[model samples]
Target: MSESVLKTLVIYTATLVIAVALASVLILIPAYVHYGEIHIPGSYNALYLSKYSPYKTIVVEIDYQPGMEPTPKTIEALQQQIEMYSGKEVLVYLDQDIEDDEVPAVIYGYDIIKITSMLQEQNRDYRTGWFGGNITLYILYLDTIWQQEDQDYSNRMHAASTKPYSVGVTYAADSIIIFKGSLPQNDMETTILLHELGHVWGFGHTNESSNIMNAEFEVYRNGPSPDDVVETWYPKDFSPAQKEELARLHETMHILALFN
Candidate 1:
């Protein structure tokens, strides 16, 4: 081959290699971010936090299968949690619009997202725009489990027993999925919901076992402290530090609203 042609070939090959690497990063970053494995700084601060959103109204619009719905107590608890996070008025609207028969026994994040497009449009109170309406946060309650694409959680040493430990997931900034079938009762149901809601508000996992944002529950739900428990974290609710931060924001939003 001619020296000039070989030089051009080398340049083209280098350019192609760089292009492939860039494309891989572009794709993998979002996939990891979507799966909650990658944390982006201040991902949803403007939408969920921030002292100056266009409005101070957040609507918790839930879509549930016929057999799986958040209990009244869970509803109240999550409402209070989100209210604290956004420092705004939160309205709860549950729609029993999903059919258990229609849900697949095993699904992934994208599977439910495909269905939410229609659900969001049909939600009577759905409003995610910035102006003239409340911000809508979407949640799905399903009787079946949602298996993550990369999470090999089918078998694990859960705090309770050897069972899958996935209870909830936040696949998008404004969407959460609750594995209603996996929740033994209202307590974990409430805990997992609040945990996912924390994710929506830009909270990342912390090592503090007592903090609500701790990611230990992702591996095992809370159980009585046994000396040999695999995962040691037992988060009852939001930690004091998180609460203080949220309280300051909540108070600021309240004070800001008064001036508006």
Candidate 2:
């Protein structure tokens, strides 16, 4: 082979080797160091911590329907739950109530897809992406009566995490919509909020029902009552595995914040 051709081949081989090594590092680092779970929709792994730093405070913004504002007790319960799991300062902010005319357009049914789409349309600012510390969450409380269309579904789904975590690209503008009439006694509302927040922070559903990330929820129905009160059982707290995952995420966020 000519000298120039041989030199060109060597250079191409070296470049291929370097590219493969770099790709491997990117894929393996998360597996070893644990940078949170990869979201299904976006396939990104990192959870975006607010620019305010989790060590200081994580703000939760609530946008409720008229007269459906979460009670102070519910706020306290949510704060306590977040502090317990994340070991971060919890700050709750009540944003203005969603306009009456916009409520119908925002909530089409109990389906999370439709709700998220409507929310994105009406409030483009709330779309998932990197954002500052003004808000880490945007929860919407639907005061209307609604039910899951699935007949076989046992537990009444109180709320859902509309947006998945996207690494570096998506912020924590994760949304949760709760039906006011569906809440049962106990801190059920708080439970649902924490569960959805877990999803926003890159936690997936668990098989263990006692864990806060449990996939199955037990529905509680009032047998004889004029109001027909109903709610789902709330897990007491996060499992050990979940806490470990969250700790890893916090550490990763701290390291990334340092560079930023």
Candidate 3:
């Protein structure tokens, strides 16, 4: 090829390459970064109601193993709680050996997952009362006698942690389990059950024993603290105003991002 023609061709090619590189860097890079920011979870700053409706409810069947039967009053208290959440049906399956004629409920054995799925479909929240589940809970029944280091107690804790139960909306877990060697005092039973359920609802322990989440109860099973009640009953759903507030929040965040 002629030298002049070859030199012209080289200059033209280099110009095209530079233009393409500049265009890509100036346009494509920013577009890609912006695209990525849009698709991230909780991005677009949107508000969403839970797929599960707050109104519907379900109750899991509770059964007591050989050593872990709960009391009639405790069972009744559990039922009252279930009712408080909703008028939806509460089912309790008791061991054939224990008879409580005063408490009006039927107990039967059935598939847990199937039941959970049904509850999910119904958009219901299931409450596990301290007394009912074949799944037994332990409490420091007699503080003087109930040893924390007991092998049996340790084994029970291990089993509860390992055993799979549908504990939350996203995953199933063996929730913190408790067992009482003997019946807890009236005040203690209610407080413990309330506190444990608090944990189930995503509340953590607090220094305040007056709080339901406090571990001061005689038998702290699936209980909630006052904090638990606040956490669990606090409307999880965002109202129209809340949605607006969330949008405002996102706007505020974007505005703040400008300074950063």
Among these predictions, the greatest lDDT belongs to 1
**TM-score winner, 1 or 2:** 1
Q: Cα miss at 207, model 3 (Å)?
A: 1.7
Report clash pairs, candidate 2. 129-171
List candidate 3 segments past 4 Å from native.
Answer: 1-57, 96-176, 182-187, 218-260
In the range 162-252, model 2's lDDT, one tens digit per residue, is 2211111122325555655445554666666666667666666688767876654424343333244343456756777877766666555
Candidate scoring better on lDDT of 1 and 3: 1
lDDT of 1 by residue, 18-51 (tens): 9989875676433433433122323444445555
Q: Assess every candidate by TM-score.
A: 0.65, 0.57, 0.34
RMSD per model, one decimal: 11.3, 8.8, 16.9
Writing each residue's lDDT as its tens digit, candidate 3 over 185-232 gives 333444444444444333445555345444333323332222222122
Of 2 and 3, which scores higher on TM-score?
A: 2
* TM-score of model 1 vs. true structure: 0.65
